[model samples]
Target: MINVVGFRYCRLGTADLEETVKFGTDMIGLETVGRENGSVYMRGDDRDHNICYFEGDPTDHTLGLELADFDALDAAESTLTTAGLDVHRGTGEEATARRCMGYINFKDPSGNSIDLTVRPFAAGRRYFPGRDAGIDEFSHIGLRVTDPREAEKFWSEVFNFKTSDWIGWSALMTFDEVHHRFALFPSDRPGIQHINFQVSETDDVMRSNYFLRDHQVRIQAGPGRHSLSGARFLYFYGPDEMIYEYSCGVRMVDDTWRARQFPVNDASFCAWGSKPDLSVLEGPDAAE
Candidate 1:
């Protein structure tokens, strides 16, 4: 069983680097750190960077998840190989993409590109938010799984992630300590469903909701609670049509915890005030 740690970073290709960086810092609450030839790095809450934007065609979107250690990485590579999945040892520039000592690349069953890395760089600097909204850390990822059943089995049986609950076909998953480091939702497209950042409280969600609206940013959904994790959340669209979420009050799970299974239903997915936003359900190829 591979012991994955948590979300590391997400890389997306953009036609304009400066526009993306400004949007990340000035609009989305991430602080800019550094920029190379064509790549811009911005971080939230002390990590060197949790999101990197690169100048390229708009089609590239990659997600990176860090394993616990080299042993875990080796175990992951072995697992992917044993599953007859193609795995690539990251080289030269690929290593720089994650700012890690080592990395291996592979695609999930849904063909979502994922990079597994060891020793991803975290700056030794303190984090002070450019626009404070009680921002804490990058939390779980919402992925557009082609088939939730197969995706859930792959993560649980192969990667050893434990399911916390199921909101219909959507699976809330985690490993070791964190509530849910990842989630799988059935969708027609093949890319990240949404990226979430956990905040401090419902106040933080309300704060961000008003702040983003005042700034003229689109409020996609929320300022309401999710029945799945029972977290208060706010989802807003960021640059490049990426969905950014701020949530609080996540539940945790360990070995003794039994998986809570629920049939896909509206009540289980959204609580009071969280109306379904079809924008989040749209696939990558949907009209922008």
Candidate 2:
């Protein structure tokens, strides 16, 4: 297994870099950290950056995972290569661009880009938000997959991510104690379904809901509690139609916790009955 410590950051390509930066800072409340070579780096916590918006095709997105060290990274590369997957080592320039000491890039079974890095950089200074969105840190991500089973197997076998629970075919997975660092949802195409940030509390979620409404940002779902993680959430749309979420009060699982499965339904998704426009989870052909 790759022995991933946790999720590091995400790199998103956007046609309008400036607009994306504005949405990230103004709407999402991320602190702008740096800008270089047509990319803007933003952070929600002490890490140098949790998200990067660069000028490119909007479909180009890369999720980063932090490994313990160079040895673990090397083992990951070898393991993936042995499994017949193409892995590319990051060059010095590439590493410098990402503010990481080293990294390797590859695509998952669902064709989502992933980077495994060593010694990911963090700022010594504390994070100050551009707005009071009440963000705590960049949290889990929802990954759209054509085959949830295949994607789940790849993540579990390669990175040793454990399933915390299941809502239908969607798998809520974790690397550490945090409820879920990643989630796999069945979709026709591959991309990020949503990027989530944990907020200070339920009040934070409600505050952002009103803030987003006044700002005219499209609210996608929530201001309701999730049945699975027990988190209060708000999903809103950002630039390039990228979905961003603010949530709090996520349940943390321990070694003694056993994973449970629930049928894919409104009840499984939300305890308060707020519905999301999730076409990906609708059809009879949806993930098993």
Candidate 3:
């Protein structure tokens, strides 16, 4: 059931890829659309690129997802090699270094890194930031999971995500309808625990919270307001320490939405009362 559909790009691994592509374009506004082999390509919207840095192991990560052609990428690599996992299939120069026309790769029981592509590559216009901060797109993410209920039951049974709420054991997943594109977080190891991007309101999340405090950066919380996707966030800290967000209004669900449950404190992670250190969703190795 690996139907995913789209949420492409994120191939990070940076121990100074030109100082994280100049801190993702002069401090997280992202735009630089291309660099080759050693990788770089950025963008906040207008697809074709969403994050690629490279060079290597700053806790290397990868997350591209999208599948609908090439027979749903050969039926999601034969349903993740018949469910035992260990898929691979991406060649052709690793699908031209993942600008994608095909892809596979795997690792999910909390090891993060998944790719799944098929036909991905779109931007023929729009997107030109490099420093707008009011940029909008490249939305959800915050994965890291040692075992948030076996990574939300292996992404709700091998990939069509789902859950849309829950705070203690984390969760907030999604397949579509925005409410979340994944929020898991219960780390011990495993990467990406933040990297959202939607911004175009709440004054671009309080003008990037004083433009990341006059460029000293390191904010790590909100401009406030998100009791479950009501968005309007801020969270900072970039480059190798990762974690960069800049939300705005988010809240869209369908199928009559439902999922709830909010307990792990701080007004369920902010509701205009910011207090960031969620202890990384208090996973504590989630029952190691």
Candidate 1 lDDT over 1-288, as tens digits, reads: 666776788888878888878877776678888788778888777787888789986557788888888888888899899999999989868787678988998888888888888988879887767678788988778887777778888888887688887666677888756768877767775677678888888898898888899999988777777776788888888767777899999877777877776654455556774676644333233212
Strongest candidate by lDDT: 2
The total of clashing pairs for model 2 equals 0
Query: In candidate 1, how many clashes are counted?
Result: 1
TM-score of each: 0.91, 0.97, 0.34
Worst 10 residues of 1 by lDDT: 279-288
Root-mean-square deviation of candidate 3: 15.3
Q: Name model 2 segments beyond 4 Å from true.
A: 283-288
lDDT of each: 0.78, 0.89, 0.85
Over the stretch 88-190, how does candidate 2's per-residue lDDT look in tens digits? Answer: 9999999998889999999999899999999999799999999988889999999988888888889899878999998778889999999899888888878
User: What is the TM-score (0 to 1) of candidate 3?
Assistant: 0.34
| Alpha-carbon RMSD, each predicted model | 3.4, 1.3, 15.3
Extract clashing residue pairs from model 1.
Answer: 168-264
1 against 2, candidate with superior lDDT: 2
Residues 1-288 of candidate 3 have per-residue lDDT tens digits of 878878987888888899888878887888888889888889899998888888999888988888889988888788888888898888888887888788888888877888888888897888998888887789888888887998788788888889989888888989999999889888788888788889888987887799778989888887788898888788888877888888888999998899998988888889878787877888764554
